[model samples]
Target: MKPAAILEAALYVDDLAEAERFYGQVLGLDLLAKAEGRHVFFRCGDTVLLLFDPKATEVPPEAGARLPVPPHGAHGPGHLCFSAGAAEIELWKKHLEDHNVAIEADFEWPRGGRSIYFRDPSGNSLEFAEPRIWSFT
Candidate 1:
């Protein structure tokens, strides 16, 4: 059977506090939970955005640990794109600019819709695009 929808998305960050400020303060995602020097979780409408400290997650949990989630992480910059409507994308562009976040790329897709790309403090590529870019209704 095919999986349903994505419930959460994760991104690796070196600084949890900085990440918290960016996602919570700048992007306006509601804070869900956070562990200092570890990870920060945010609510993004129907899904959750998980910002993790790679240094902490790359190592396996000690034997007999309370939560024995397997070690998982990524190195260097990763990418995450948020789905938005045409109007919302425009508003987001302005909001990001007001926050002094540089927009690295902005353009319309050859087929349709628009997308803007930017980087978080940790250098992960973040994008906002009309879902129509992929022909999603």
Candidate 2:
């Protein structure tokens, strides 16, 4: 079977409201749905981004209990990446820079195109990569 692409990524944050403000207002993700104090969902192209409160207690038993967030400076692999064309990448770079978002780096691959790295208010590493990264066989 072919590998299925990721449909969504759930980030456990200290506050869902803050996540909504950052991802929705700051980063400008299209808000698709939300449940107060529990979670918020955004539409990233065809994929979904789910933000949840780390302290929320409404999860089903089968979903397990919520856990505390890791202390600062402890590294983790949780991140969300967006794919864009070269022009779209530039547009996002300008938009982010104009909004005073700190850019971690902007790098180009040997193949073609480039990427920009940044973080959300919750410190989740977000990457916007050029779609051409996958164009080559």
Candidate 3:
């Protein structure tokens, strides 16, 4: 199947300290930026997971931003979900388990769908899934 639009996204956190503890310390997301209580950005490969609190600091819009910008970025539980294959999924699970990260749920959906769910310190539900492939009847 051809690629469509953005399948992944990110969210802001109420507490940067807590977010860093989970997403960085636990989940192993590389800390892209750490500006005190402002926010801590994580670089998840091509995508990004942001932990910003409005009470923190304000980042003014860049008139000539290089990357494609989001229209309405400052909002609620941004919901950044990632998709992976079987091998990658297993590896990620093992890594998270090794770090003592709690698993919210792990199940195989109807028709071969597979997924695992977990949350960061800020309590945002994060999931990694594999879509089921079905043949025509």
Q: Give candidate 3 misplaced runs (Cα > 4 Å).
A: 1-8, 57-78, 131-137
lDDT of 3 at 75: 48
- Best-performing candidate as measured by TM-score: 1
Candidate 3 C-alpha lDDT tens digits along 18-43: 88878877667898777786668888
Which of candidates 1 and 3 is the stronger one according to lDDT? 1
- In the range 95-126, model 1's lDDT, one tens digit per residue, is 99999999999999998989999999999999
Candidate models: Cα lDDT each: 0.94, 0.77, 0.70
Candidate 2 per-residue C-alpha lDDT over 1-137 given as tens digits, one digit per residue, 9 for 90 to 100: 98588887777666678889888987789999987987799998778998876555443334443644333222343677788877888899999888788899999988887989998777878899988876857
What TM-score number comes out for model 1?
0.95
Please list all clashing residue pairs in model 3, or write none if there are none: 9-80
Model 1, 67: alpha-carbon shift in Å?
Answer: 1.1
Relative to the true structure, candidate 2 has a C-alpha RMSD (angstroms) of 5.2
Please give me the total number of clashing residue pairs in predicted model 1: 0
